[model samples]
Target: MSAPVLVFGWGNPSRGDDALGPLFVEAVEAMKLPGIECLTDFQLQVEHALDLRRRSRILFVDASGTARPPFEFQPIAAARDDSFTTHSVSPQSVLQVFEDLEGRPAPPSWLLAIRGDSWELGTAPAPSANANLRAAIAAFTAWLPDL
Candidate 1:
């Protein structure tokens, strides 16, 4: 059977701070918890829509400059956007595509935003970014067991 929860994280690891999403994936994978599936990519593409299929719940993780603290979690609803036609789509757009293809509503989904400052090309995460990543991982570690 498919896992009940899917954690999908995407970001460019080579960019400073932008690696938060995929790093979060790595941490979660290490836990090897039951009924949870983890996925990571450089970016959210339209092809990723299929990942939502057969999931009971979904979490989309990324680094956000405007988000606060360790991380921010908010419910996501499937909604079609003009951007859906593009190759690189947002999590919401991916959900919309899932709905379109499956002819049904998507599972409950949340977007997890880990705060980050710099995301320059070809740089390691800054010290402050590492702090944020640690906090986010801790926060999710606590949250995951309850799911």
Candidate 2:
């Protein structure tokens, strides 16, 4: 059966700290947890809204320079903006799209932002960022049970 929990992690793997989101998805996948699905992408796009169908909960994981690592998680309400009229969209915009097309509210959703200090292309992740990433994986893994 398809998993009810959907985690979509997006970042450019070629960039240094930008790889954190996809890396988290990989760590979670290695656990082989039941009833959870992990997906990775380079960025959030308009078409991603279609992925929300039948999901129980959704998480958009991304690397953020502003996040005070190991990570930050928060609920995001569906909202639309004139800027979202473009091909790409924010997680909130995606939720809004899901609701607009599905004729109902999107599933409960949250955002997970992993802090990264460097985003230079072709460079490796800094040690500090890697430590933060590991901590986030451990912390969130435990917290998932309560979701």
lDDT of each: 0.89, 0.88
C-alpha RMSD values across all candidates: 1.4, 1.4
Score every model by TM-score. Answer: 0.93, 0.93
Which parts of model 2 are misplaced by more than 4 Å?
86-88
Q: What digit string (tens of lDDT, one per residue) describes model 1 on residues 1-147?
A: 679899999999999999999988998999998899999999898788888878989989999999987679899998888886676688889999898899999999999999999999999988888898899888888777667
Candidate 1 has its poorest 10 consecutive residues by lDDT at 80-89
- Single out the weakest 10-residue window by summed lDDT for candidate 2: 81-90
Error of 1 at 7 (Å): 0.7
Model 1: lDDT of residue 136: 83
Q: Against the true structure, whose lDDT is highest?
A: 1
Cα error of candidate 2 at position 77, Å: 1.4
TM-score of 1: 0.93
lDDT of 2 by residue, 27-146 (tens): 889999888899999988878888888899998889899998688999997898754776556899989988999999899999989999899999888888899889888887887888
